[model samples]
Target: MGHADLVARLVEAGGLPGEWRSVFERVPRDAFVPDLVWDDDRRPVHRAREPGRWSGLVHRDAPVVTQLDDGAPDGVGYVSSSASMPSIVALMLDELDVAEGMRVLEIGTGTGWNAALLAARLGDGNVTTVEVDPVLAGLARARLARAGFRPAVVAADGMAGWPGHAPYDRVIATAAVRRVPYAWVAQTRPGGRIVTPFGTAFHNGTLLRLDVRDDGTASGRFGGDVGFMWTRSERTPHGSVEERVLPGHDHTESTTDLHPYEPVSDFDAGFAIGLRVPGMLATVVHDGAPADGRFTVYLMDPGSDSWASWRITPRPRGRYRVRQHGPRALFDELAAAYDWWRRIGRPAHDRFGLTVTPDGRQHLWTDTPDRVLDLVPDPGKERAG
Candidate 1:
C-alpha cells in the first residue's frame, strides 16, 4: 500500500481523529527505525541487505523490533524496544487528545517515531520525551534531528518522568507498566490525561487512560488489548518456561475436566485472572506442530519457583493430566481465579478500572473505585512510581 493508503487504513481502523491525518502523513516511520531491525518472528532484516523487505516492514502497520536484549551481544535475546504498531499508536494518540501547542511528555522513546509524530502535530518545542536507555535515547535524538524534528529527548529513567518540564498537558508511555507512575500524574496538569499500557505477570496487557484530578489522584478505565513490553524497571522474568517448568520433576499429579480454552486463550478471562493472582505467568508449549492441536499450558511464578502444567490431547476422554510442584500451587491459584471470574459474570476487560493514590499506590476496581479489588500492594514498589 502507498503511504497515503496505509495512513488511511490506520486512521479508519484505529479510530484516529481526522485532525491527525496530516501529522501521520508528515512523519515518516522509516526515518526513526534502525538499519538493522528484526521482525516479529525474530528474523533479522538489515536495510542494506534487503531494502525491499525492510521497506515493506517499515511501511506497514506492524511493529518492527529496533533492539534486543537491551543491545547485549550475547544476551538471552529478550525484546527490549521497538517501534509500536501503527494502529495502536494512532489509538493512543487519539486517547491523548492533544490540541495545538499542548505540551506533552512521552515515556520510552524507543525509535522516536511516535515522538516525531507528536512533534509534527504539536511542534518540537512543546514536546519532551524521556528514554531509560541512554544509547536508545541518543540514537533517537539523532534520528529526530536528522528528520527535521528536534523534540527534547532526555536520557533518563522514564518511570520518574521528566519533571523539569512540569505541568505537561498530556503524558503517554510507549512501554507497558504494571503500575502507572505517580510521577506522571504529578507532572501532568490537573485536567490532563495520562495513557500507558498496564499489565500483570499473567498477561501482556491492556491500555489504561487516567485523568489526573486536582486532588493529586488519577482514575480511569482500561481500554484496548495492547501487549507492549514492560518498562525495564518493572519487567516480569524473561521467557523461562522450560527452565522453571520441568515435567519430569517430582510433582503432585491430578486430573481436571477444566480446559485451557477459556482461562488461557480468552483475553477477558486472562486479564481478570491476572488481577486476582499476582506474580504469575503463563506459557503454552506444543507437543508437535501446533496444527496437531496437542499442547501443554504452563503456569509459573518465578518469585516462589512454583510451576504447573496442564496437558491437552488431540482426542480427550473428558479428562486431562495436571502436574504442579513448589511451595505455591500455581494451578490451583489459576483455577480459583478463573472460577471467581465466572462467578462474577465474566466481565470484559473494559469494565475494569484503575486509580493511583496520592502516595503512589495503585488500586484496581470494577466499574467504580468504591468497589475496590482487595489487591495487596508490594511494599517495595509502593513508591516505585
Candidate 2:
C-alpha cells in the first residue's frame, strides 16, 4: 500500500536488513522518481495524469524505467535507465556491507535513489556516483538535491570510475559488464569490496562480489542472478535477426531430441552455456499459443554472419528440426555448451566464480580457481579451406 509498509514487508522477507531500515524509511523512493515513469512492461505512467497508478508502481518491489534510450521520445523507446527494484537495491547494499563514514563509489547514478540511500547511511560527502550521460547525471543530481541529499555526482563514463575521489572503501555498479574494469579495482582500497553485475555478450549474468587485493587483482563468486542494463560503452544493437538471415544463404537441416527451451529457460543452465560458449546470443520466438508449444530459437554470433534456428513443436517425445548456416554451426556450439553444463551437474549461480588478474586476464572457474573454463581456440576444428 504505502512505501513504509513495503519497506517493512521487505525487511521481514530479509530483503532489507535492520541496519538499513532507518535509511530506507528516511529516503523516500518517490522523491527520486520522475513525473513520468515506465513500468516493467515498458508502458509509461505519468504521475501528473495517473497519480494513483504511479504511486502504486513506485512503491512496488519492481524497477521503474525512468529514461528510455537515454531520455529520447520518452514513452516509447528502449529503456536506458531506471530506478532499480527496491528488493535488489537492498540485496546489493547488504552485500556491500557499508559502514558509517566509509567512502563509496557508485557506478550508474540512474534516478539517484541509490545515492540518496547511500548518503543517508554513510553521509552525503562519503558517496560519489558517476553517470555516463550528462542529461541523466544532471537529472539525478537535481533529484538527489531535491531529496535533501547531495553526493558528488559526476557526468562521465563509469568504467573509468572517479579517480579524483580515489581509494574508496567500496565500489558498486548498477550496470552489467562483461569484465570488471581494472580502474575500479585500482581505485578501491586494498581489502575493500567491489560489487557489480558481470555477464557475457549472451546477456545472462550474475552479480559478482570481489575483494580488492593489494596487487589490484579482484576475485570472487557470483553473488546472485541479476539483470541490469549494459554499460554504455558495451551496449550493442541486437534483436530478432530472422530478417537478416533471409533465405538461400547456406543451411543444413538436422534433428535433435533436446528441446529448444531447456538451456535458455533455466537460469543456471543458460548462464553456464553463456560462459562455456562465448560470443553467442540466444533468443526464442513463440508461435501461436504457448499451449500449442511451437517456437523457434535463434542463435547468432555477433563476430560473424553465422546463425542457427531450432524449430520446436508440441510432442511428448520426438526430434526437433534444426537449421544452421554460415561459418559456425551455432546449434552445434550451443549443444556442446549445454552438454558441458550437464556434465558438471547443472551447477547453480553460486557455484561459479570469476578472477580478474592485475594484467586483465579474466578467468571463469567452477567451485575452485584450479578448474577454469577454457576459452582457447581449437586448431583441431579449423576448417580446411
Residue-level lDDT of model 2, residues 270-319, one tens digit each, is 87777766667777777987777888889877556678999888775578
Instruction: Compose the digit string of candidate 1's lDDT tens values, residues 1-385.
Output: 4567778877777556788888888887888899999887888899999998888888888888889999997787788999999888988999999999899999999999999999999999999999999999999999999999999999999999899988899999999888787899999999999999988888878999999999999999998899999888887666478788776678999999988989998999999988888777889999889998799999877777788989998676548899999888989999999999999889999999989989888888889888888874222122222
- Evaluated against the true structure, the overall lDDT of model 2 is 0.83
| lDDT per model vs. reference | 0.87, 0.83
Q: Which ten residues in a row have the lowest lDDT in candidate 2?
A: 376-385
Candidate 1 displacement at residue 112 in angstroms: 0.6
Report residue 373 deviation for candidate 2 (angstroms).
2.5
Model 1: residue 322 alpha-carbon error in angstroms = 1.6
Best by lDDT: 1
What's each prediction's TM-score?
0.94, 0.93
Candidate 1 at residue 181, lDDT?
A: 78
| RMSD, one per candidate, in order | 2.4, 3.7
